[model samples]
Target: MTKQQIWEWFANHSKQILDFLLFLALVSMGAFVKILKQVRQGAKASWKWFLAEAIVSFFVALLVYGFFDQFMQTSTLFTYVVCAWCGSFSTIFHKRMEDLLGAIFDKLKQLISEKKSL
Candidate 1:
């Protein structure tokens, strides 16, 4: 692609790119917390565990971004701040959030089935 074409493409997709970066930042923050906890407990921290938590945080951040994006446009700075706040809890809460979402999905599925039977 030409320079102008590339610039235009980046301009158009900047918001998406920023959001993706914010998601990664959020995951990083969560991973940092997990590592700290390991240090506090005097346990040897593994890069593998940090990677796993980061992966989980990525999905959690995806859900958070979707929910927020539906309401308004998010500025990069604001996104960063929000991600930092959310990330603080992500390591401990992401799994619980996933379970809760699963329960909600199950309820919705059951409701749809009942409606179809009716």
Candidate 2:
């Protein structure tokens, strides 16, 4: 399609597009947490974990979006911030937080190793 046609189509469907993107972002966040958990535990990432992550992400997205829609009624920046916070908060529990933080530090260590090797 032409650029103009694509632009018009996107404008018409912007809300739907934005919602889908937000859903995908939430799913990614869930998957990231699962991956971090696996990494901390020395387990491999697999499709089973991914599917579980997706399911949790779907409900989290619904709760976040529904809450904002019901109460705050859609300011763009607020929606974005709250959705991001929801993704982060949903992933982190008390015990998992320490593991996740340590995993992050390990990644940083790896980065430092690479820099030293270079």
Candidate 3:
């Protein structure tokens, strides 16, 4: 691509890029709470656990945020902030998301069965 084309593309995507960066910054704020606790407790811990938690939380929060945004449209930055505020509770959010999906599937199944009956 030409310089102008690249610049145009970057300009077009700058908003999304900014939101993505914001997402990373927000999700990241809680990724190291355990490490901080470890330091406070004066327990030497391997960095691998931190890395694992960061990666896991990142993906979990991403999924939770995606599902939330899919169900309800809202400001991306605000959503990220709220998700981050939930902190280590992403597993809870994950479970809620599962329940939502399951409910939707069950509703569809009921509708299909009704149609078959008709």
Candidate 4:
């Protein structure tokens, strides 16, 4: 298709396109929050780390979307790419958190058993 054809198509679907982008952004932000919680754990929660991660994720996402908007004309495909990246990162973050929790639980159980033996 010609350049005019593409521009016209984008114009017609601009609202839907923007809505999807906003949705992806919201989901990514929510995932970041969950990851932050996981990283906190029991007494190791650090506000500095949390804020740093938040800032980094924000800039990274913005840079990615901006690059795509400037260099790529396929908005739908770009949306899917963002969604996939965020979803995968969130899943991995959750798994790591689960592992951390399990380790903490195991340590607690060991402590309890040792106390009982005393």
C-alpha lDDT of all candidate models, in order: 0.70, 0.70, 0.75, 0.64
TM-score for candidate 2, residues paired by index: 0.50
- The backbone clash count of each candidate, in order, is 0, 0, 0, 0
Model 1 misplaced stretches (Cα beyond 4 Å): 71-80, 94-118
lDDT of 1 by residue, 11-50 (tens): 9999888867766766577657756866787866678876
Better of 2 and 4 by TM-score: 2
Supply candidate 1's per-residue lDDT for 111: 100
Query: Model 3, which residues run further than 4 Å from truth?
Result: 38-44, 90-118
Model 3 agreement with the true structure over 12-52: per-residue lDDT tens digits? 99998888888888888866663465567676667886776
Candidate rank order under TM-score: 3, 1, 2, 4
Each prediction's TM-score against the native?
A: 0.54, 0.50, 0.64, 0.40
| Candidate 2: tens digits of C-alpha lDDT, residues 1-116 | 99999999999999989877876675576557655766687776678866665566556656777788788798755665566556545555435868989999999999999999
* Model 1 / residue 116 / CA error / Å: 32
RMSD of each: 7.0, 16.4, 8.2, 12.0
Question: What TM-score does prediction 1 earn?
Answer: 0.54
| Model 2: residue 118 alpha-carbon error in angstroms | 77
Query: Of the candidates shown, which would achieve the greatest lDDT relative to the real structure?
Result: 3
